[model samples]
Target: MGSTLVQRRLSSALAIMTFAVLLTGCGTWWHGDHQSVTIFTTPPDAAVVVDERVHLLAPGTVSLNRKGNHHAVATKDGYESAVMTLSRTWSWWLLGDVFGCLIVFSPFCIMHDIDEGGYYTFDDTIYITLDRKSAAWAPVK
Candidate 1:
């Protein structure tokens, strides 16, 4: 009877651990709210501005928040600046959150991901081309 009691306790503990793991939002637990995005531009050393704040030079990688839409502007001397918007969209990770949390009957898990912005994601890479200004209007040396 003593060994049987210990075995039952072990099984209960294992079950509880499994339940807790499932209750953790799959999206938040896996992807979180920050994503690394790579940028490339026609002019190799063009200045890249993200959201008019963070600055980088392509080709490079920047970590961006996944909560909302973001924009990038790439510019080089004598070239027209190029702008691109990185929009956040629902991802497969959100589906993982829905199914995994549903298995544990925990709506809070899904809601937690929604509130944390883990259900959305941005593209992994961005590429832009800057057109050179007209010869007639080119900057004087």
Candidate 2:
């Protein structure tokens, strides 16, 4: 009976440790709100403005929240400033989060996105073209 009790306790301890590991993502660390994204321009060196507030240079990386729609605008000298929106769509991996339910405090699997070191790259490379607004000759006033 003593031997049997020892085995049972060992099993229970193992299970609890496993549960804790899962909750911690097995060493995966991440911030709940911070996600990474990369922005690039065709010509590069364009001033990239994000959310109309944060400014960055093209071919650069930026961190953004995963909660809402994010916007980026690229402007280069003599080029028509271009705008693009980066919205957080549903991540398919969230479907696999069902197993995460077993671990308390680990809803990460079911979360909206996968934060692999916040290295999400923009899907499309922004392209900007130079714009020269044509002026029409007018009569002297």
Candidate 3:
């Protein structure tokens, strides 16, 4: 009876843990390599554009891929446009998925990995100070 009771408890614990793992997303269960980055500027409220398409205001956050150009442009009415590029590096946590997916519950773990919402691991902050555009001008010849 003692041996049988121990087996039941052990099996119960395993079942609960397995359920939790299955419920967890790949990115949540295993950290990703990139993350969302928040950008802010000195002047504030400037037009922030990325890759010539994504547009937002200063003091905004953007989710960027781990691998891609992070160039952004910030422009305001009387200020010179600020062009900046962010740095992105490989994250060691990306290896976590390898271990998580290796388990028997990999099928459910892979489900979250396939979703875009669960993936974003960038680690960079962007801050820009726009310079006032020079008022002086010369006549074009």
Candidate 4:
């Protein structure tokens, strides 16, 4: 009876350990590599340029890779252009990667999340304010 009880406990512990290891880098699986970010301007409609490449009209949404920070510029005919940076920060979901890898004694387990850009996140919505240029220099729109 004593041996049987020990075997059961060992089995339970092994099962739990296996489950935790299997969940390593859960953030990579759950969050993926891309996220949608919405941009809204104070004056509503304006042209937005991202990374000096993708062009989107403000009051819009764009899908961005989570691997790095981004730069955005918003311009209107009469308002001074607004520049903003979209920065990436550690995501709470990465805690799963941290804990799971620690349990397995493998730092490599967390690499999956980091390499896949799942360890970071961006703000879902961003608001930008545009200042109107002086009447003398403002473009007539």
Candidate closest to the true structure, highest lDDT: 4
lDDT computed for candidate 4 = 0.88
Question: In model 4, what lDDT does residue 101 have?
Answer: 76
lDDT of 3 by residue, 67-123 (tens): 454788999999999999876554443344455556554655555554533444455
Rank order (by lDDT, best first): 4, 1, 3, 2
Q: Order candidates by TM-score, high to low.
A: 4, 1, 2, 3
Error of 3 at 79 (Å): 0.7
What lDDT does each candidate get? 0.84, 0.60, 0.69, 0.88
Stretches of candidate 3 above 4 Å error?
A: 1-29, 32-34, 94-121, 137-141
* Model 1 agreement with the true structure over 82-117: per-residue lDDT tens digits: 989888889787776666665567788778888887
lDDT of 2 by residue, 54-99 (tens): 8988788877775566888888876677877786654433333444
Q: What lDDT is reached at residue 2 by model 2?
A: 100
Which residue pairs of candidate 3 clash?
34-120, 34-121, 34-122, 35-120, 35-121, 35-122
CA RMSD (A), model 2? 6.1
lDDT head-to-head 1 vs 3, winner: 1
Model 2 residue 34 CA deviation in Å: 0.9
Candidate 1 has an lDDT of 0.84
